[model samples]
Target chain A: MPETPTIPDSPATAPLLRLSGLEQVFDTKRGKVPAVSGVDLKVEAGKVLCLVGESGCGKTTTARAAAGLTRPTGGSVEYLGHDIHRMGAAEWQEYREAVQYIHQDPYASLNPVRTVLSSLTAGLRKHKKVKGRHEARQAAARLLEQVELTPAESYLDKYPHQLSGGQRQRVAVARALAMNPKLLIADESTSMLDVSIRVSLLNTLGGLRDDLGVGFMFITHDLAVAKYFAWDGEIAVMYLGKVVEHGPTPQVINDPQHPYTKALIAAVCEPDPRLARSKKTIPLRSAEIPSLTALPSGCTFHPRCPLAESGDCDTTPPTLAPLDERRRLACHVVARDHVAAQAGTG
Target chain B: MSEEPILSVRDLRITYQTGRNSEVVAARDVEFDLYPGQSMALVGESGCGKTTLGLGLLRLLPKLGRIPQGEIVYRRKDGTTADILKMGKEELRRFRWSEAAMVFQGAMNAFNPVQRIGAHFADTLKDHLPEGKRLSKTEIRERSEELLRMVRLEPGRVLPSFPHELSGGMKQRALIALALALNPQVLVLDEPTTALDLLTQCSIVEELHRLRAEFGFTMIFITHDLGLAAELADRVSTMYAGRIIETGTAEDIFYDPRHPYTSGLINAVLPVVGDLPQLASIPGSPPSLATLPAGCAFGPRCEYVQDRCREAVPALEPLTDRPDGLTHATACLRAEDVQHSREVVSRA
Candidate 1:
């Protein structure tokens, strides 16, 4: 599983990760905490984007500024079209081995005294991508049989407290597919498993994004697992750290044009008891989420939205744009009701 | 709703010890009832003993847990009853929080981080008074500012702050206003809106459905979220390697589940509404309550397992008999061939 490094077939034009106007901020002795502010996104190659929101909504600072792990106090992450904070150390070691990440506590991200073949062959023998210890134990048993954890020689000498939070998140997605990465981010990787091992670790990460083309960003706060692993990829949502609804995950989860993505898809909870008592929950005028050092000037969810409008969502902010021709939106009253329903059907 | 029940339980079990001459059973033969304003839920997953049967229904286990065998019974508020494993220590401390209380699964370290949320409501109203009844300090600051303004919080900026100054939905609405300070007629909770934040778990599930329609009590809870047991259950159950295979209502356990581990935890959930269906997941991994499986502790993740499901345990029973008594029940030994192959695959 290592010898496939030829990669630059180029033509499908650039996006194997981009972020743009990203911002991050921090400082915090109770001050400059803007935790991600502009956040545009893209991913392509084997699509999927997800991100969704909630807990201090920055979706882990826009996935640690798209996994160049932090550094974005303001915009730009890019990756394949350069600028991973201005690359060059061999293009920042090919954007750090084609970008990888994974983390959301597979019990505090692996390494409980290592093992699963020394954490999948220590980044394929520190990026030489295998040359010894028998081809790094056959590329760590083909990454524990590509995360299904089959008889990969009974999980190559076990450990991380002998596995099972869905086999330590399939050995943290086989240590992020031993760096053949081309984008993976993950954060909250199957939110600490067990809904029958979170649908077989999301069908082994939707079979590594359809048999290894890979690209994903994924992060989640479970909009039913970002509508089942980005149903045909794309969904954005976020909140105080901006991207209020971007589209195509079945039209941002079936027509959500943002009142905070229809109050996070009407605050979720549906495993069905007549769709959890015939759904419809919207309600928020304030269950209180503000304070990123007192946010709420323009639309940081206009003091708990429910159709906001106090002087156009309290003096401006909206900015996501495009509401149709496949989604986008950020809400000044749903872009004035999609421009008065396209001026009443033109 | 033929009245009477307010907590019943029965052939319970519990156990724990795990050493010198071992011991494990973590909840077994557990039965149930509840009735008075009932809610139920329990659902399973995480070492499914549903928090050791919600801390063995209030005798709150821990210390190598115990319970041992059966009965819980309950029913007090003067219409007497008893059992909670033969009471005593001051009748289980005045029948716990004035007759069944709980709320616990992490309201960020369930209070006492250097007290002050009005001294955890004046030390749970000065150690659950009534024996020489006392209260004072402006009748405990007007009953802890009327239980933090009945969970809408604000009590003069949360009774002089401190449990790390509020938020995680104000310490789960001040731990459901200190588990409704002694107004208990049963509450339990555990994983109450687990680690808050889907709009603070939808305003703490709409402040527990408006505090169970303005205080009607009898709740239970324990979760592993099946969409919060289909949004705050009206009876549900499920549990796995720690026994209860199924029990119903919440539309017979989410539209007729007859336990192939509650239809593989309702087709492994992921439906934030519509399309993208095919799910699967229940293939082995939930047996160990110390090497269980030899008889349906969800027999190796039963996709309708048989061979008399490893020849033994399968009791839960019922399956129908409702006229609103809410029965359903399941356990399974091919629960009528998995409800006749789920009514011939949902009638094709």
Candidate 2:
């Protein structure tokens, strides 16, 4: 057997952000929908934690909770060992400045009426990062250059509509960087971009993680993108408001333990024609995702899971538990397999 | 392999009148031969004219959009040939769902929210029925049910539902069924599996594969996704700035792309199954059609670009010819110099 992968456990410094038992329930007219349930995650400075799942799988809900955008209906969002909801005004302001959010649509995120300079320097001016218009302009130019919108003066006076999708996304990144944020929560930031532009934007974001020591809670539905952006980081696979699998990027991608992770990875259409022809798909029992309001009993993914057993999988819900020293899984079948393997080895 | 092409487009130009005297050429000088039962993928970024070309093929361009100059030679079901651009109003109306149909990009907006799913199919069949043929209500229901079942949707539950009642995948499948209601010889799908979950996309791809095998219809799908193109297309065409920059068999396009833009696009895609490869994005964005550069549209961002590329546009020249007119061609001046190896982009 291959040796277990090891992620450096830095106990010396507190994580930049942590979500402990994070839960979000929306009381719609139809019913109470549990969008995110008991999700635990950690992002240290300069590290990435990618949340990969399909739509309505609670990736966005988890991200919003982590960003302190919405007060969680249950559990707590802690930043630097302090609960975000219980922080004082000074602490809240610091937390707000420390954690920034980059929305999915660049076209809609940036104000169409505001020029690039004004948008970039709005947060800076409000937060007193720059004293005057001259200083703000200089600071904005520097921020734009940091995101690789070079010769920044040319872009300073332009509106959002004048720039291309890729260029507009760079401005969004520049606006986030203006806050000097320690952590950034980017929700499907590159999904709207073309393949070429998407890769370039990912490269720029990866650079920010390394150069500025910024932690990222990147969320996307594209597995290839998650693999590329968070290769050295961790990936948490969410399925219907719960994390089904969590591990190092390479480990989860190459040797997926959870059936959902395996199925998702198998479902991706590789760009190469040879691979496309040779790929083997994991057949699901059902194609439709269960509705959030009417969730299935026990393990939510059990209905579609090919490996799901009759009594245990249907009667009891599985908790996200440590599968190995480096990974966590929430499948009963996989957990049983791990136990059996341990018993045999011992 | 020597069979006649069902759709042969030559020097096709689609333009939109922006002002009194100004017109923007969305697609120009586009030439290709789509053989019967062939699946062709039009791959490009947004605003690259793939959609415009697809719309133009069916004469479905908006009121402002017009086919200024081109010959879209289409072979009818009875083996008669006619130019789609020159078809009379009545002829075009009859030719549209009966000869060729389109599954638009967003299935949500493609459907009417108030109408039941069955009505969409009934309307299509009733409007496109052959001359002097009357269909009973029972016949329409039977046909619509058969179409829905072919796409794996239960007609009993789905037929009575509104567009908002079905999921994105179900809606897409229903739209495909509606498009096939007339049993058109050709189908045009724009971003069929986009905006869907991974598993749903996989099922849709599989469904399309099965449906094509059973129906034996020609297909032309427009998408920005290289992965989907690799999966569904037998022939791949890469478009850049209103022109097909490269055209070839799937193997040639994926394995040995000659155009710098095509190579760059292939290299930019990240694979999920293998080791992470170094990817390099082309430097600049696609140019606006209104103020296109002097010569090659991709010249500004192409690594293999030279002074020759900026002087004049290059025509699509065939590099290798195959059976059924499946020729590997590209419009790059430095086609010979640009290597197809993945290492070229990785090294950059």
Please state the error at residue A302 of candidate 1 in Å: 3.1
Off by over 4 Å in 2: A1-12, B343-348
Tens-digit lDDT string for candidate 2 (B1-348): 437899999999999999999999999999999999999999999999999999999988999999979899998767899999898988888888888999999987899999999999889988876667778899999999999999999999999999999999999999999999889999999999989899999999999999999999999999998999989999999999999999999999998999999999998988787688878888888999999998899998888878989999999999996876589999988888987666322100
On TM-score, the leading prediction is 2
Residue-level lDDT tens digits of model 1 in B296-328 = 777776766768879899898997886443798
Each candidate's TM vs. the true structure?
A: 0.36, 0.97
Stretch of 10 with least lDDT, candidate 2 chain A: A1-10
lDDT of 1 by residue, A199-229 (tens): 8888888888899989888988888888888
lDDT of 2: 0.91
Worst 10 residues of 1 chain A by lDDT: A1-10
Question: What local lDDT does model 1 show for residue A105?
Answer: 82
